[model samples]
Target: MALCSKIIEHDDTGRYLTINQIYTEPFPSAAASGKLRVEDNNGIVWILSYRVKSGGTRVFSGDWPRFVQNYKVKAGNTIVIGMNGTGSTDHKIEVM
Candidate 1:
């Protein structure tokens, strides 16, 4: 789906990730208020919930700490989130 965003310092420290508004724009209305299944490149999976705040959406989950720990993602990294298929409920994550 070509959805991608940079990992900011806040993401690493706050244990949460922000989904850019450009990416969220195409999400189904319900998606903005629900959980999404995000899978990393190594097949690790996390269920992240979306929150609408300050006119934008951010995604976070209880497993965020684990994900960060396992992935070793740092600030300034690029994280890409893409749907597995058309209308699929699962999204894949790529770190670069």
Candidate 2:
């Protein structure tokens, strides 16, 4: 029982996103697939992969420093991913 069909992404301005494009039914395995969408300062959108269970972004990347430095993601800008989860997990993504 985990967050399924989830997505997470950040923008050039450091705005993060997490959306559920799949579901309406609990397939579990079906929700395992990643489905993230991000919008940058330029208004361009990007799709991010789902965070793998407990392993986290280790399979992805750890860019807290880089993310903090590059984007103003806090407060209204604080990017949130995996709403189904604790929402405390930080998935690293280097926005280029």
For 1-96, candidate 1 gives per-residue lDDT tens digits of 755556657545356776645534544542555766777766767766655556565555566667767777778777777776633246776777
TM-score of each: 0.72, 0.27
Q: After superposition, how far is residue 33 of candidate 1 from its true place, in Å?
A: 5.2
TM-score of 2: 0.27
lDDT of each: 0.63, 0.35
What are the C-alpha RMSDs, in order, of all predicted structures? Answer: 3.2, 11.4
Native-vs-model 2 lDDT? 0.35
How accurate locally is residue 78 in candidate 1, as Cα lDDT from 0 to 100?
70
Please name the candidate that would achieve the greatest lDDT relative to the true structure: 1
Worst 10-residue lDDT window for candidate 1 reads 23-32
Residue ranges of candidate 2 with Cα displaced over 4 Å:
1-30, 54-70, 74-77, 80-96
Please provide, for model 2 over 28-72, each residue's C-alpha lDDT reduced to its tens digit, 9 standing for 90 to 100. Answer: 332365444433344433444334444232122233334445564
